[model samples]
Target: MRHQPFETWLLFDDPLTPDQARALDEHLRACETCRALGHSWRSVASLFQASPDLEPAPGFANRWKARLVQEDQGVLTARYRWQSWITLILIANGVSLLGMLLGMTFFDTFDSLTEILLVLVYRLTSLLTVINIFQNLLAILIRTIPGLLSPSGWAILALIVSSGSLLWVLSMARLARMPGRA
Candidate 1:
């Protein structure tokens, strides 16, 4: 009969049958790997059997619950900070753009609608440039903040802002260059 692999040992808790026992004994004599596996399994089983079963301290569950709550709060706080910052930046940019258009259209007298629209477009472009400068400055400040200064954090922030600005500029430029538009 062929020798049994060590994995077969896990199938039976009681003593192996005569043929199976003989096969395992023969394999263990020839294979150091199988012998070591069997030894390790027995050692682990013995360790589990030897250890005493005891309940944790009275505050253990409470401590773990508190820890989980703290972790959740940390995640929520970070999410809210990011959202608020983005929202503020967006609102500032939108208000600035709208103010520029209103100033150019209503405050500055133009002889024709075309002239007024052209002025508004020019002002919008100028406002976008100003916004970009301010956004870059903000990114630099974020990167330099005392406890938040990390190369990876700065790199990620720079990447996100740069990509966003690039997309915004490209879309705006395309719209500005479209023929028949004021």
Candidate 2:
């Protein structure tokens, strides 16, 4: 009635001793359940052996990989778009809040709209005055700098700069070429 060794022997690929094989054959003859199991197992194994190995068509792997990448890119693009929308909305809200706060403060401090306009004009005038001062200074420097240096002086300055650059380059090259430095 016990089917332990006989079932294991029939199902497994382990080789059986002559005595074990004889005992298994005797058990198979008497045990209908084990005999049917063994028969089905052999039939399934034969089916597997007779069938050809299935392979994908050419470029199938490449197509599948490309599809995966495309899906990932779609997901990333949507995420980026969502983030961009959120950022734009937040920035708009912040600008609106700042404008409202500044307007309220300015209205509370100033008596009239004309005062606000005058203050804006004064600030713009100050900024423009500073810019104009810098522009005039730049113009003066541009006019006087060339007069300060003769042609030979300019050539000497260029030579000095080029020699310094060449020295730096040669030092770097030597450092790079030194062994055990990497």
Candidate 3:
């Protein structure tokens, strides 16, 4: 149609206010092209209405659940498929870094690396001393734990742990029992 807005209204499903609807109707009556387009759209709408509504086959829910589980498992498996190779590459990289560090520390064949090597060894020894102190404290804690407690103390500790675990399970059960929640 020569009238552009009426042609748009005829070809597409556009919302029409009362005034716009009246103008479109007036245009359609005078324009043969717009009238033909409207008739075609109505025919298409009728065809769609005449078609039967289709439903999925039986066991749809069970089948859907099975498919979902299968896809999840497949994704999980694929995600870890390169685990060994990735781990191997990571280990190789770490070892290479460590070797490079050590080489720069002690493998200085020439005296040019001597100064840097001494500085690094001094820093490393200080770090090791701190680590050793922490390790000794942890060892002392482990050794004294049993001796610092009597049979009654052990029983009390066990009672506390059991009560806490029971409370946690009860809370989880209550949450699962709530409406609109799993």
Candidate 4:
């Protein structure tokens, strides 16, 4: 049987009009499901009414606030790390381009295309060697540094490094924006 108005009337605490009340009564009588639902809803409502209100445990608010602050800090840290990586990548690309341009300028003195290509290959090999050396040094530093520093020490080190990187990025941006640079 269609429950409709009967289920709605049973679930809600609103006083029904005489017509709605008559319809709901007829539905409830015919529909076993609606009758059972109405009974269950009443039981639930009574349980809710009888349940006592209780206060939160002590320090709950303070702990919740601390958690929120820690979460915010984590988000900020992640953002900063992402931005730092992007800045580092941009800086590396800029340096590589500048190096290539300088290499091309130097190769301009050469008479033949073969000599230019040879010089370019030699410069690329030298650059790769330097990069490999730096990568090895970075790997060694990563392995060694964590054991040497406490959490606070690491934080301080991070702050110093980030500040330096920020200053460098800002300076580079300012220089790029300058009107007179060729």
Best by TM-score: 2
Misplaced by over 4 Å in model 3 are 9-30, 97-182
Model 1, residue 123: distance off in Å is: 22
Clashing pairs in 1: none
Best of the two (1, 2) by lDDT: 2
Question: What ranking emerges by TM-score with the best candidate at the front?
Answer: 2, 4, 3, 1
TM-score of each prediction? 0.39, 0.49, 0.42, 0.48
Clashes of each: 0, 0, 0, 0
lDDT of 3 by residue, 1-182 (tens): 37788878777776889998999899888988888888989999999999999999999999999999999889878877778779999999999999999887665654656776787899999999999999999999999998988989999999999999999999999999999773
Deviation (Å) of 143 in candidate 3: 35
Angstrom error at residue 56, model 3: 2.7
**Model 3 TM-score?**
0.42
Worst 10 residues of 3 by lDDT: 105-114
Q: Which model is ahead, 1 or 4, in terms of TM-score?
A: 4
Clash pairs detected, candidate 2: none
TM-score of 2: 0.49
Q: How are the candidates ranked when ordered by lDDT, highest leading?
A: 2, 4, 3, 1
Per-candidate local distance difference test: 0.85, 0.96, 0.89, 0.91
